[model samples]
Target chain A: MRGVVLHGPGDVRVEDRADPRIVQPTDAIIRVTAACVCGSDLWPYRGVDKSDEPAPMGHEYVGVVEQVGDQVKTIKAGDFVVGSFFASDNTCEICQAGYQSRCVHAELIGAIGTQAQYARIPLADGTLVATPGPPDAGLVPSLLTASDVLGTGWFGAVAAEAGPGKTVAVVGDGAVGLLGVLAARQLGAERIVVFSRHADRQELATEFGATDILTERGDQGVTQLKELTGGLGAHSVIEAVGTQQSMMQAIRSTRPGGHVGYVGVAHGVALPGEELFFSGVHLHGGPAPVRRFLPELIGLIWDRTIDPGKVFDLELPLEEAAEGYRAMDERRAIKTLLRP
Target chain B: MRGVVLHGPGDVRVEDRADPRIVQPTDAIIRVTAACVCGSDLWPYRGVDKSDEPAPMGHEYVGVVEQVGDQVKTIKAGDFVVGSFFASDNTCEICQAGYQSRCVHAELIGAIGTQAQYARIPLADGTLVATPGPPDAGLVPSLLTASDVLGTGWFGAVAAEAGPGKTVAVVGDGAVGLLGVLAARQLGAERIVVFSRHADRQELATEFGATDILTERGDQGVTQLKELTGGLGAHSVIEAVGTQQSMMQAIRSTRPGGHVGYVGVAHGVALPGEELFFSGVHLHGGPAPVRRFLPELIGLIWDRTIDPGKVFDLELPLEEAAEGYRAMDERRAIKTLLRP
Candidate 1:
């Protein structure tokens, strides 16, 4: 099987690798139809996160079940399925409480890498959601996004309590943030404000339901957000960029008693306790329980109620994995979808 | 008139002062009957919060309305009232959303020194909640607690979502934390756990409905809490101590989908964003909006349903305000009440 592997900083390669097998009775092997490079993958590719050894790369995938372990009762071969980054039992107390990402028996499927011709999924019934049937080729990209980015953005919107009567502000213009705008709009937010400097991202954000766009960054961005919301700041703020400046801006861009739903993977961010306390905002976020929202998101995609696939601005073949990583890293693409 | 003043760190004195007079159309002057030394007061008294001048001290007060400005409509002279530290207009959007402490017209009543014979309260109609009538002397202390400590604890419990079937853990055993245990009990928590090292405070916590007591601090306390909660951590955790260790312990003690409501005045605390993000817990707190809970708290106190005054184990006359501060700062008294 061919898979994407990271050898070192600025290095991504597609190489022959041993095929994944069912190691647990609850596992299922799937022939991946589509996989993509995630924003988080850039952490290692850019050397922000050091890797001591060669590491497998993608976590988002759509595939057809090729084999199922004996204990797998709900999932079977020949089914089209989508799964998120983390494999959870989906029945643990935490999972039942809607935090499957932190389930007691959780495993990071990203460690095995979904960017391969075939992948093994554990807790098959809990982690993978099967489509009604084989999805149309045109629906593959949207279905693939339900695996992580779309689910994550949906979770961020829900965590921020975005709904009718809410003025929601998004702090990033990446795929997750753009989708967060879509999620917020779908969730009925009265107004959506996005901070973006790129014209392309701004246009896409507008199409996705952003009513206001600010080119400012940091304190200036927060000021613009507050001005747009009548000096009280937005009622709901989505933080999709994991940086000190972005986090603080998101926090500051919310009104007192508002909510901040942050989904970006944190990197060296230390929140000042005094400012957070005085901000009087509810803070909730983390590795999103993408599994919890997979079923509904799949339905939305199947019904064409949303066009999340538009986030993938570039597409490449599995053998061009290195180019995909470079395009995203250099800001040439919002996201890159690779066919296996 | 006489008031308590902080000359510098470790320097408190009772001295003659000008009697307060209404300065705004919405202000009212009150004859303070009771004032208390709060745990937060110890910060400035112990040099954790520096002072530049002889600042008037005391924010919590139970008093009788001495006079009302012409525009004051809700409160009248001769009325017995209870007010929190911050005087809020109570009609702002923020106040309407149950965050009166951060109201647009909020004024710190402590700046005028409620420990004095007469103090001016801004936003009189919104800040002062009148009792049924002049209460018996025996109920004064309890009523005083409602002004700040009890209301703060109630807010913490509410923020943590303490209710039926929830397991609650309290960090810190000060007046606020002990009352948080009481609040959790009133909210029908299935079990209450409190972290405390002092025997006296521990006994008070148990009396206030702590089902479990762990005389451990920091990580050890968190470990004990998890062990007691079936290794999943408490569903709700109250953080009443504003320190890094206590904040981290509170976050670590809560389950992934749980809530942490912190009320202590934060000092020199920086929350590592990565840890907080991965913790997957909801964090909400800051200066509690005591005014939001005053009406209900006053009713409970009036009915003798809760005896929060027990936290004031030591009492002193107005002339001994310095001693009250000393006793509380040295931990010799859980709380010290002063009669002016």
Candidate 2:
């Protein structure tokens, strides 16, 4: 099987790798149908997140189960399934509480490398969410997003409590941010504001139900959001960018008693306790429990209720994953999809 | 009129002050019947919170309305009332959203010195809550607590989502933390754990319905809490200490999907963004919107359902406010009530 691997900073390669096998009775081998590069993947590529050795790439995917371990009763061969970046036993106390990402027994799916022809998923019964049947070919990209970004955006909306009459502001113009705007709209938000400097991303944001778009960042962006919301700031803020500036902007752009849902992969960010304490806002986020929303999101995608696949602009064969990384790193594509 | 003034660190003097008079049409002058030294006062007295000029002390009080400006419609002469430290108009959008402390026209009652014989409360109609009648003489202390600590504790419980079957843990054992135990109990928490080193404070916490008392501090304290909750941590954590250690403990002691209500006046704490982001815990707090919970809390006090006054272990005449401050600063007294 050909898989993506990172050798060093600004270095990625797609090379032939040994095929994965079911190592545990709770494991299932899946034939990768589609995978994608994530914004988080850029962290290591940019030399921001430290990496000690060569590591596998990609955590998001939707594929068909090719083989199941003897004890894997819920999932079987030929079943199309989507799994989150964090593989969790959905029946654990943590998962039952809707925090599968923090499950007591959890593993990063990226560690197993899904950007390959085959991948091994552990705890199959809890990690995989099967569709009613084989999904339409057109739904592949959307279903793949449900494995991570789309599900993550949905978590952001829920964490921010975006609902009827809420003025929600989204910070970041990535796939997750645009999808957050879409999620807020689907959740009944009355007004959605997205901050974007790029025309292409701004257009997608507007189409995804952003009522207002501002071409500003940081303090100026917060000022614009506050001014637009009658000087009180938005009722809910979604932070998709992991930078300190984006995090602070999200907090400052929310009204007192409002909520800030931050889903960015934080790096080198230290929140001053005084400001957060005086902000009088609720904060909740992390690696989202994408497994929790997979079923609903997959249903929505199958029914054509949402077009999450719009986030994927550039596509290439699985072997061209190196080019996919370069395209996203060079800003030529908002996101890149790979077909196995 | 007379008031307590902080001449310098640990230097408090009861001095004669000019009488307060209504300067705004929305103001009301109140003759204080009971006032108390707060845990927050120790900040300045201990020099942790710097003060250059002599500043008036005390913001917690229940008093009788002595006079009202022309526009002060709801409160009048002789009406017994309680007002939070933060005065708000309650009619603003922020107030309507239940964040009266952040109201557009909010003012701190401490600015006018509620510990004085007379206080001019701004936005009287919105800031002061009248009792059913004159509160029973024995209810004065409890009513005063409602002006700050008790109300703050209630906000902590509410914000932490303390309710049936939830395990609630309190991080501080001060007047506010002790009252947080009571608030959690009142809010239907199944179990309440309080971290305390002092026997007297522990007794008060248990009397306030603490189901478990742990003397360990920091990591050990968090470990005990996690061990008690089947290694999953509590569902609701009340962080009433603003120190970094306590804040981190509160966050660490809460299970994934749990909530943290922090009302401690944060001093020099800086929360690492990475830890918070990965904690998977919801954080909400600030100077609590005590004004929002005043009516309901006052009602409970009036009905004898709660005895928050039990927290005031030392009572002194207004002239000995210096001694009162000394008692709290030295930890000789849990709380001290000053009569004016």
Q: Mark the regions of model 1 whose C-alpha exceeds 4 Å error after superposition.
A: none
Chain B of candidate 2 versus the native chain B: what TM-score? 0.99
Write down the DockQ of candidate 1. Answer: 0.91
lDDT of 2 by residue, A155-239 (tens): 9999999999999999999999999999999999999999998999999998889999998899999988888999999999999
> Cα miss at A242, model 2 (Å)?
1.3
- lDDT tens digits by residue: candidate 1, B1-340: 9999999998899999988887899999999999998888888899888888899999999999989999999899999999988999999989998889889888887787888888899999999999999999999999999889999999899999999999999999999999999999999999999999999999999999999999889998888888898899999999999999999999999999899999988888999999999999999998889999999988998998989999999999999988888888788999999999
Best by DockQ: 1
- CA-lDDT, candidates in order: 0.93, 0.93
* Native A-B interface contacts kept, per candidate: 0.91, 0.87
TM-score, one value per model: 0.99, 0.99
* A158-228: candidate 1 lDDT, tens digit per residue: 98999999999999999999999999999999999999999999999999999999999999998888778
Candidate 2 lDDT score at position B252? 96
